[model samples]
Target chain A: MRYKVTIAYDGTDFAGFQMQPNERTVEGVLTKIVNKIAKNPGKRIQIFGSGRTDAGVHALGQVVHFDMNTQMNEDNMLHALNSMMPLDMSVKKVEIVSEDFHARFTTHGKRYMYRLSLGEFVDPFKRRYTGHWKFPIDIKLIKAAIKDLEGTHDFSSFVAAGSTVKSNVRTIYEASVRFDDATQEIVFEFYGNGFLYNMVRIMVAVLIEIGSKRRPVDDIPRLFQVLDRNEARGTAPASGLYLKKVYY
Target chain B: MRYKVTIAYDGTDFAGFQMQPNERTVEGVLTKIVNKIAKNPGKRIQIFGSGRTDAGVHALGQVVHFDMNTQMNEDNMLHALNSMMPLDMSVKKVEIVSEDFHARFTTHGKRYMYRLSLGEFVDPFKRRYTGHWKFPIDIKLIKAAIKDLEGTHDFSSFVAAGSTVKSNVRTIYEASVRFDDATQEIVFEFYGNGFLYNMVRIMVAVLIEIGSKRRPVDDIPRLFQVLDRNEARGTAPASGLYLKKVYY
Candidate 1:
């Protein structure tokens, strides 16, 4: 039987999602704990994920599926795994799913949130989880900047140059910028069919630059039309981005 | 001239309060930053605190004072020192006080807060600032245990052994416990004339053990009366405690 697990992680201490030989990775840790709980200590389990989140990139709805022959109930397995897992990661929800259910292909839409702490002092408590930008940014300018990117468009300007997507089109259902005074965090939320490699980060960079008055808000549309990666601003750090939700 | 400063810090990365050679100490960082900001770089500044905070112990109002050259304006020095200091250590307030104002001697009351995450899974985001305790604890029992220590008494039973306190008799102003569900944190707030070494941690240890039903809530008063260090519960981790305020 296969089980689908929804997990959340801090991602500060991890190298990335993929399992490396020696470095600490989220997938590697999850696999190890899953194997240990299944009573197959050395068995290689093929864990499938919805997507690969970069190093220092966090996730709340990171869906994964794995098959096992163990008889341990989901509650027991969850408790056992949580006890062995480091404090940086936690299994939020776990359930039995159809053996044919694919975590990657079955997803419908996903939301990503990029958080930037804009204050005099970067919150030391949240230094690892948030990106700090010291410049004063205009909220109105950022709100107007991302408006042009709301509809379907060729998003080559937002995608990383190393992205392997044959088609660069993505339809954003919603996009907005808001500031939280309590947390002193500026959040960018985007709902899309999917995101390109580093797409959210690149878009965030453009929005921040626009908010800082370094770039015109109206120029965002023209930059996308040009389809030149050099025309876009630099990509934001991975720590600021989080996979917030996925609707299947 | 001397300046009184109120300090706040995230203690996860610090070794301890006192300055040490070739180590990352809170006092060491403050000294270095002050030297960098002051004109007299050769002057070894004295940072007098109410007391020493152990490694991994945080503070919101750890009071300190230092004498500097008369040429340095109090406000300018405060701002300059904070600017040059790291993100973790912050100067919350600074004032030019009476020459007799000593951080340790003039202090009248002090408050400490202990934060505990009493859930099955500790949030990855709050791992550094919170102490995770998965075992279920009874708040009523904990409150009853605290009630037994709400007045002036010899806290030798609660204070760690070999603590260099000249006297064990300290007056406690208030001792209370509250839980916040949204943050999943149990906060223990205590105000006293002063504290012995590891006193709050040891008190929290006894309270937590009582709350967990491992020890009886009524046993707390007997421990205080007995004045035996080994009769009480073990000391809680230092990471859970914070110097919340120091009053003068």
Candidate 2:
């Protein structure tokens, strides 16, 4: 039977989700805990996640699925798995899913939130979670640039160089930028069918530069037509973005 | 003429705020950056901070002051100093105060905020920014425990051992907790005249235990009456709390 698992993790302490022989990964850690709890320490479980978040990136509704040989009891598995996981990562919920359910292949959509702290006062407490930009980012220009990102188009301009993807075309459902004056957080929330490697980060960099008036808003649409990586301005730092949701 | 300045830092990647030989510290990094700008190869700028936050701990208003003998505009100094500092640390404001603006001694009040992600969904993005507790925390229990903590009190029970403070009596202006449903972040903001070493951390540990109902809330008040350190629970993790403000 296939099992659906919901997880919570502190990515600061992890290298990423995929396993490396010498380094710690979210998938490796979860696999170890789940296998230990199942009393099959030798069992190698392959957990397929809805997305592959980069190192230092984080998620809330990160979904995954794996098949187990033993009889499935969702409540018992949830409790047992959670008890065995490390303090930084926990399996919050577990359920039995149909054989047809695939965490990655069946993912219908995804939502990501990019948090930027723009002001003189960069709260040290929020430094790890938000991107700190000291200069004034022109909101109107960023909003104008975001309009160019909406809808389906060839996204080769936003994809990072050396990516292995065969196709650069993807559909973006929504893209918007808004600032919270009280907290001084400029949050950009995006929903899309999928993203290429470092696509979101590059998009953010272009938008932020546009917001700073370093690049014109019209450059977004123009860059979409170019297939070269150096044609885009820059890639924003990875610290500001989060995998907020993965819908399936 | 020499001037004093204040600084704030996210100490996750720093050894500490104070400079140490051959180590990455807030002071060490600042000193390097400042010296680079002033072109003073042999100059030593002494940077003094209000308190030393441990590794992984954060400071929203970590006060620091230093003196330099170079002629640089305030805007230039701000730009140059920040250009050299790490992205996690920022100079909120620089003022040419009276030569007497001691970063530590002239402070009147201060505030710290301890954040806890108290629910199931732990956003990977916010992992470094908040402490996660999977169990349900009793808000009423935490409130009851903190009631005894308000006002002037000798907080030796909450202060970490080996701290060289002669007195633990400190006046608290405000002590409370708030919940953000949208983000599922539970924040504890405390405004106090000063704090003993690890005072906020120890208090958070006790409160967290109480909130989890692992210990009775009345135990907090009872433990305060005792003079021994073993009477309370564990110290809260350093990642959970932050220096929010320094009122000078």
Candidate 3:
């Protein structure tokens, strides 16, 4: 039986979503427990994730798929997984799906959100969750700059160096920024067909710079035309990013 | 000169507020930093807190007082202390106080808060910040039970066992419970002249039981009459408790 599961994690202690030799990872931890429940004889039961989130990047609706020969119910599987997993990660929902559903290849859209704290000093309780911004910012500038990111465009300037992808074209369906006055935090949300490695962080960095008047708000369009990674000056910290959802 | 400082700390990593031999404590950490800033030789410089909070309990407005011979400005002192202290703790405010000011002895009232999550399975991100309740709860019942706890009363039933305090009489100035729908968390706030050891946790436990129908809503009156620690039955976990403020 093929199963689809939605999970949420704090991601503070995780090396990343990808598996490495000895580092603790979301994929490694889930695979170990999935293999245990599968009871596969000397064979590894791999769990497929929608995409990879960098170290210290949280996830609220990360989807995964795995196969098992056991005839256990979905409820039983969810209960077992939540019981065995560490306190920082949890299985929010589980469903038996067709073998045709692939967690990664079948994905059609993705949503990512970033949070920033506007404070002179970092908050003790929020240090692990929110990225701190020390400089004053004009929200109108960020909002104006973000509007230029919508629609299809070649995001070559936003991609990190040493890229291997053949195409830099991606369609951003929506981009919005909201300021929460009570918490003194700003949240940026993006929904797109796909995003390249470090794309959201790079865009956030550029937006922050524009809001702070270090760069002109009109620079985003020129960077897209230049197709130079060096033109994009900053990358936001990983702690602020969250994989909000994956749509199939 | 006498210095009074207000600090906020994420107490998840500390053993407790009081100093213990070979233990990582909030007091010990603050004292070490204070002595370093004071530059006192041979004799140790101690920082006195308003009260001791149990291990894993958080603080948003904990106050402390200490003496130093240096004549540095308040801004420099605040910056130096925040820079030297661990990331889990930060100085919020600092001021040059009178010689007669004392953190503990001069305290007048306090405000404490407890957080509870009404989720079947604990939320991964909120695990460190909120207490989980597996059973169904009625906020109305808890509110009814809480009304009897207001006003001046002898709260002997709420004190923990092995307590050695001379008086159990305290004045409850106000109490409130607010449920945040977006976060699915309940926040309980209490303002009182003083609190005994584990008093807030014990009272919260009783209230939770009443809300969940394990006990009658009228149990508060009877428990006060009993005047026994055994009447409280349970104590909420330390993670959900927060020392919100210390009024002087």
Best by DockQ: 3
| Cα-based lDDT at residue B78, candidate 1 | 68
TM-score of 1: 0.91
Write candidate 2's Cα lDDT for A104-200 as tens digits.
9999888888889876655655765777787878888898889789999899888887789889999999999998876778899889999998898
**Local distance difference test values of all predictions, in order:** 0.85, 0.79, 0.91
True contacts kept of each: 0.58, 0.37, 0.68
State every prediction's TM-score relative to the real structure.
Answer: 0.91, 0.84, 0.95
Query: B76-104, model 3: which lDDT tens digit per residue?
Result: 99998998989789999999999889999
Q: Write the per-residue lDDT of candidate 1 for residues B55-98, one digit (tens) a residue.
A: 99998889888887766676787678778768788787788887
Q: Which candidate model has the greater lDDT, 1 or 2?
A: 1
Query: True-contact fraction for model 2?
Result: 0.37
lDDT of 2 by residue, B1-248 (tens): 44555677776778766677877888778777766776764656666777777777887777777777766666677767776767678787666656777887888988999988865545444556678787888887887778778888777777778889899788888889877786777788889999888888888888889999898878866776785677775887777778888888
Which of the two candidates, 1 or 2, achieves a greater TM-score against the reference? 1
lDDT-better candidate, 2 vs 3: 3
TM-score ranking from best candidate downward = 3, 1, 2
Query: Which CAPRI category fits model 2?
Result: acceptable
Cα deviation at A214, candidate 3, in Å, is 1.1
By TM-score, the best candidate is 3
User: Clashes in each model (backbone N, CA, C under 3 Å)?
Assistant: 0, 3, 0
